[model samples]
Target: MPSFTLPRAFRAARITRTHKISAAVVASASCAATLALTAAPGNAETTAAQAPAGVKPVSANGLPLTAKDRADDGAKDRQVASSLTAGLKVTAVAKQGHTAKQAADRSADRKIIAAPKAAPNAAPKRYANNLDGWIRQSLAIMKSKGIPGSYQGLHRNIIRESGGNPNAVNNWDINAINGIPSKGLLQVIQPTFNQYRVAGTANKLTDPIANITAAANYAANRYGSIDNVNSAY
Candidate 1:
């Protein structure tokens, strides 16, 4: 039997087919190696998922980190947590302080509301500047000083002594001869006036209120009361 040699085109086709099959086999082997590498325990994605919570498997430069890096990251996380806890405590304390201040303010407001209001000032009492006014005013003062005299007694004495004259002076009497003339509505002498002069009255001998009060005081001391003096005591 004689061996037949194939054409150049058929030979070239066969070589091309062989080359394609070898390429296919090589690609399949490369794919299988990639699949094995992906399933390995040292894979980046699998390692990252299997790592503990809050731990990063890779660094910022896209490289896998060591155990020291993970520990540093955990320490940073704890530091942040501590700072947050301190912030929360401070906020709570501030809220408590604010609530206490509000309560204090409310208490102060209640006190203000419950406090009594001040009464308005009343107008001052007034009196006329005449003889009747003077007698009434002197009577009020005498009552306060515990001196005893009635309006009728005072009026009768004034009519007899000086006829209601506030500036009367007894110049012809023995009291005048002694150089201590009796003066004023009640005819009181200088020494007696000075001794028995009521407080809050004018110092002048002829001053109506002063003279009346002083003479009435002297009458009360000597005769027990001005109402008992019907003569020139």
Candidate 2:
């Protein structure tokens, strides 16, 4: 066999590099083509491209499409027409609605619990030191998770119940029947205590955040508001 020379070695190396670069380029082009094919039809627009005139279901690559992608193209015309008719600003419109809701929520919050106060001499409450912080956190949870009507009502009702005392309870049988741990701001009963399964466990009632959330969920579902419990008990 003839021995290979340096020039031949150099030629081989160049060829190998060229092959590698060619393979990479081909792979990249293939990927791009596949993505493009998976994208909207010829007339369709890419998601990165300008959004259409109205709310439109889009392919992965961002083109006007039907919700069910694999369906017949015939349905595409009518469905897309409906989508446009309903207002083509789907992404923008939905996002705008959410933004507006968040803005409104913030506006309402400013008016609601402007300066939540914690009595200096009183027992533990949600805002042991930072009343405003606690109120803000609670309000955020309410806005995001949709606080129940009862829980919402309880915001004012709680001023009368525990006066924001997370660890409040009746010294006498003023709140409950058995004198078991009617814990949290809601004065959650023993059965509810067992139901939520938070009795005397770790955090206990002093956990203002957990206590408030649990109490709010309970009040919202059970009595439709904390005021009902306040009236009954």
Candidate 3:
């Protein structure tokens, strides 16, 4: 009366179709995974000059010698620096408990005292050899003080001014109309040097290192970075 269905073979054929579909799905997923792996970005590369993390870079205003070394050497010759007093001393001459007005008179008659006798033992502090070192020192100092990146104009300003030579000295430095007495790689004016306490030991100015150190320091304080020197007046 009714048509009868087939037994195991028909069901087996459907199972084969499902197995093929499952294999195709797995293959598609594997291909997608492969593409993703290929498209991924690579790691960043580091350079030779870059120091490993957490290290303080060198800073000495281009001084070939270290402050510690200077101190150590200075210890042997403390007597000499002490003896050679470039500074002046003032003595208050009080006449056996004088009155207030008498003290005032002494003040009016203030004497410019002379420095004491001192020995000249230490050699002058030396600056670096070339211009590159001078520039690097200036940049390093700026970097240390957390100067902003936009202030990079300083490096360029120095090139225009001193050609990056730390020992660069201007012939006219300040009052010299013919030229200005600018010293070191940055060609800082003598007046500027006096104001900034740029002079250190016997002769750090002519020294390229000292010049760079002082110049960058002055630039940072006055302009917030060398970039100001580079960009505007």
Candidate 4:
């Protein structure tokens, strides 16, 4: 019988080599698995990067959809945007129409309430600024205030003092020398005019009615009546 046996050193060396080879193979396989795991995320990122322009990527939690679903979603978005734009346009048009109608209504109301034109040959509503008008106005005021005077007396004084000129001013008289010139239709001085000034008459002595009223009042106070005065009164 023949017995076959290796040397102890050679056998130990062979066993050690086998163990190292096995360890190397296992380490290589584990490294390959790690590389595959790392490359999987990179491949997924590359796919995402290479996707079509303007196309929305699927969300992480969203379900996958076909091309028809994507097309329908895009159509719905466009339809909604178009509907909103149309609604805004219609609202603006309606607002403009309402504003125009309001303006038209206001114009029509103004026209409806417009004043009528004057008649062709109607008499004037105001009194003319003349001697007769002044006397009449003053007489009306005198009657209301219980002042005693007549149109004849006022006319007589106006003619005697300044010849019915309501704008008369006695600048060369003794009263003028005193720096208080007699003014207006009756040529009354400012002091006398102010002293005997009547209510409801113009404050200015140059005013025809004011002068007449004041002169009448002065005459009534001093001489008891303007009818008695005939000269330089």
Candidate 5:
């Protein structure tokens, strides 16, 4: 039997076929890897777009906000708060001013209402009980009341009865024995004095003008006026 030996051309052709199969396998693996890599980018884009509703998109910084965007939002919020605070302060100041004005107005009204009024006029008063003053006062009253008498007639009877003593009292006389003393400047008893006392004259017995006027009135009714009386009746 002769030994069989492969020819050089045949061996070369088989090695070439093996190399081509290996290259084809390497090209197929590379193409599959390229397709996977290209699809990965599309999937990532799709996933980002399909995020949950109402969720904020991520910024370049990976957090919810970038540095410049966060600073601008913070500044705007601060400005809004400052404006509100200033407006409130202005409103409070205006309210306080109005309250103070009202208080001042009330105070002014009270002062006006509490002011004092002017006093009324008054008549003149008497100073003493002198004879001239008493006579003048009695004459004035007599004139107002329509009583008739004169200064001379009054003086004449006052001198004759008790010597012008306003307090004269005759306790030892006959009138005294009957429990009725002659009293005053005219020395007239209580019954006669009280009965004859003029309306405008003093009511007291010791009054000078009262005694003289009462005695004069009594003499006028009984003896036809004091001007005709010369002695003790």
Candidate 6:
């Protein structure tokens, strides 16, 4: 093998190049180690702090989320869900209460509508079955039929004509001569009784209430009212 000595400057230059290449290789290995350390799970917080705005630090697998971070996010989600559930429950309860109140009000209204109304008038008044009873009943009927008469006036005329006898007959009177005799408590003839007979009373001329009502009706037409009659017609 032949030995040849290199120039001093070229040897120096080659040594410098070799040194530069080694330095570059060492620097690159150092940079790779630093990046590996930064991406480690323990340096997750540091990586996140150094990350750009709106960007998250990620590990080799995925986002560099710690257990506490996952726990905090889960807690926030649970809190929001719990709040929504509680709000729904409150709304449902309020709606149910309103519906119940409305139903109760409707029930009360129905009860009020269903309740019976008070009677407008009282029962019909009762009367005795005698002369005094007949006079009072006749007056009531006369008032209803618009025939005016007083109890005292009717009693006075009845006493004078038939002596208060309900079955009395006046066959001796001028009315009897014309084949229409005066009969009953008021001594009313058949023709006058038929002409002026009040409704809702007995049809017989001798009936006490019917006879009184009919005679009062006749007297009212001829003398304004039975109360004004002091003498026979």
Q: Is candidate 4 or candidate 5 better by TM-score?
A: 4
Per-candidate Cα lDDT values, in order, are 0.85, 0.59, 0.55, 0.79, 0.71, 0.84
User: What is the per-residue lDDT of model 3 for residues 19-75, given as tens digits with 9 covering 90 to 100?
Assistant: 999999766755554454345443111211232332222324633345675566557
Candidate 4's C-alpha lDDT?
Answer: 0.79
Q: TM-score winner between 1 and 4, please give it.
A: 1
- The TM-score that candidate 4 achieves is 0.45
Q: Tens digit of lDDT per residue, candidate 1, span 173-228?
A: 99999999999999999999999999999999999999999999999999988899
Question: Quick one: best TM-score, which candidate?
Answer: 6
Once fitted onto the true fold, the runs of candidate 3 whose alpha carbons sit more than 4 angstroms away are 1-129, 145-152, 172-174, 178-180, 197-203, 231-233
**What's each prediction's clash count?**
0, 8, 18, 0, 1, 0
Instruction: Return the lDDT, model 2, position 49.
Output: 45
Instruction: Return the clash pairs for model 2, or none.
Output: 47-62, 54-88, 54-89, 55-88, 55-89, 55-90, 150-224, 150-225
lDDT sort, best first: 1, 6, 4, 5, 2, 3
Model 4 misplaced regions, further than 4 Å: 1-126
**Deviation in angstroms for 175 in model 6?**
1.4
Clashes of 1: 0
Query: Which 10 consecutive residues of model 3 have the lowest summed lDDT?
Result: 42-51
* TM-score-better candidate, 3 vs 4: 4
Q: Candidate 5 residues 1-233, lDDT tens each? A: 99998999999999999999999976675565445545555433343345433333345564554567657766877899999999999999999999999999998888545666556675555735765666566556555655566677666767777876778888887888999988877788888878988886678877877876777678777887666777876
Residue-wise C-alpha lDDT for candidate 6, range 1-233, written one tens digit per residue: 99999999999999999999999976675566456556755544554565444444444565556677757766877899999999999999999999999999998888545677778897888899988998998888887888888989899999998999999999887888989899999899898888999888899999999999999999889999878888888
lDDT for 42 in candidate 3 is 30
TM for every model, in the order presented, reads 0.48, 0.34, 0.34, 0.45, 0.42, 0.49
lDDT of 2 by residue, 141-177 (tens): 6556765543346566556666778777765674455
Screening candidate 4 with a backbone cut-off below 3 angstroms (N, C-alpha, C), the clashing residue pairs are none
